[model samples]
Target: MKFEILQFPLAKSAYGGIILPMEEENKSEIFQSPTQYESRLSRPKNQFAPKKIFIILFSIVIVGLIIFGTTRFFAGGKSEQNSEPAPTAEAFPTDIPEPTEEISPTQEPKKPTPTKIPTPKPTVNPVDKTTGLDRSNLSIHVLNGSGAGRASKKASDFLESLGYNVIQIGNAENFNYEKTTIQIKSAKEEFLSLLKKDLSSNYSLGTTSADLASDSRPDTIVIVGKE
Candidate 1:
């Protein structure tokens, strides 16, 4: 008699290793090598590789920021050196002004003039020609009929002081006479009135001549008494 050979179907495992199919009754007895089992277990660790690549890209970004900040700091210092300084204050002038004209010396003072005075005139006495006896040129005779001592001389001196021309001074015919009398020898009322005013009020008057002689007669005669 002749025998036939059978061929089985092949399949791949999850770790990319080759596997053979077995019957259900012998499935528990199937086994793999240690290397193959480790390979299959480490396959899950490859999923964390993307995390390391991200760390490298982040380090490059930080280095770019540091280089940009250093360039700006050096450029700002160079701009400050090229700028201008602030301006200083200006000063004022101190000049003085000159005079317009020169001064002259003072002039001398003038002299003063003198004034003149006038001379005065002499006074003249007024005259009345109606009476024969003029007041400025009258002849008077005084008698002391009262018999008092020096009475006639006293009356004569008084008449001379008053500007009268006393021709005689003597005692009367009688000393027993009571009141005094005035006799006007020239018969002039104006002279008579003037002689009466000069004598006392108690004395009486008459136009007739006294006991005197004609040659010894005066323009007016006054007789003084005790009354």
Candidate 2:
């Protein structure tokens, strides 16, 4: 009888030998030789393969850890240097001045006293240019032609008050005179302006005659009028 070959490959036994079909167990055409099986089974087990792989992985892990530790150490040292505090300026003590006392003022300059001025007295005895005599020494006569009572006496008193010597007071020949007249010797004409200035305050002067008859007693004559 002829048996058919199996479609799948043969499996291995627990002892590492080929597990063939019982029909092919003695078939020399399909079975391997004992020496060939022995040759395959007798091959040396690679005992150092797992150990070499484990050692290579362990070396890689150890190299990574060393690199990581070195980087951490250097980074930590740099951070510590950067975190250090900067130096600050030192303080010094200041010198404070002590309080001083104020002094009072003394010995001020004195003020000067004002000087007094003297007042001058008026001249009462001015000299007359015409008579070559002082006004108080010249003789004057006052006559009233105004028909007013005591007009000549009033004029005589007024002339006397001005330092003239009024020797007489009387009435004129006619009382029809309109304005006062001043009659004097032609030599005494220089005194006319001064006498007019004095008499103009109380009398209105009219005709003034300096051609007196030269034999007249008084130096000047004042004839009082109604005006």
Candidate 3:
């Protein structure tokens, strides 16, 4: 007689084991042709896609310019409206010429009194080695400071109250107030920072320290003569 059966039943399906699905070999139906299998595996979209960064940036710039132009146009219109003087009722002339109003020597046609224009306040020269405060002055940064909190107005007001005329306010920060020796603007080579350097060549700027924090507030910068 033949040996008793020692084999077990076949696996129903394979999910994630080392052995792959043997459906092709085990199934009774015919397997797909190599050509058909290759066709199925091939995807229509094979090439990598490129980004449209240039087009996106160009569109953004165009939109920003449009907004800026619209804003400026509206602002310009508003300014022009304010510039025109409204016609006054007295501007209308009578249809019939009335007797000419006699002007006595004592009284004359009221000429609009010209408003007194304020003279440009002189800028105080920095006590540093610079000589004068002119377009040549080389201030690295100008602060638009007012002291913060309760002490905010203290610094600026105190300086002004002391008869100190601040030419430009600086941003609130502790930084070298003087321009660096390096030239930034080529056209300004002959002016501003250069002029200040030449003029103040005789002066000495004292050393800066932690204790030397600016005594001014926001929107106020103090310039004093060198000690």
Structural similarity to truth (TM-score) of each candidate: 0.36, 0.42, 0.21
lDDT of 1 at 74: 92
lDDT of 2 by residue, 1-227 (tens): 99998686687755688775566556654466777878888899866688889999999999999999999999999999999998998889988889886555775556798887776545466565555556775678899999999999999878877788899999999999999999988887777888887899999999998888789999888999998
Clashes of each: 0, 0, 17
Clashes (candidate 3): 17
Q: 12 in model 2: Cα distance from truth in Å?
A: 99
Give the whole-model CA lDDT for all candidates, comma-separated. Answer: 0.67, 0.84, 0.44
Q: TM-score of the candidate numbered 3? A: 0.21
Which 10 consecutive residues of model 2 have the lowest summed lDDT?
120-129
- Residue 127 CA displacement from its true place in model 3, Å: 99
lDDT of 3 by residue, 43-78 (tens): 586664456777788899999999999999999999
- RMSD, every candidate, angstroms: 28.6, 22.9, 44.0
At residue 87, give the lDDT of candidate 1. Answer: 80
- Give the range where candidate 3 is weakest over 10 consecutive residues by summed lDDT: 218-227
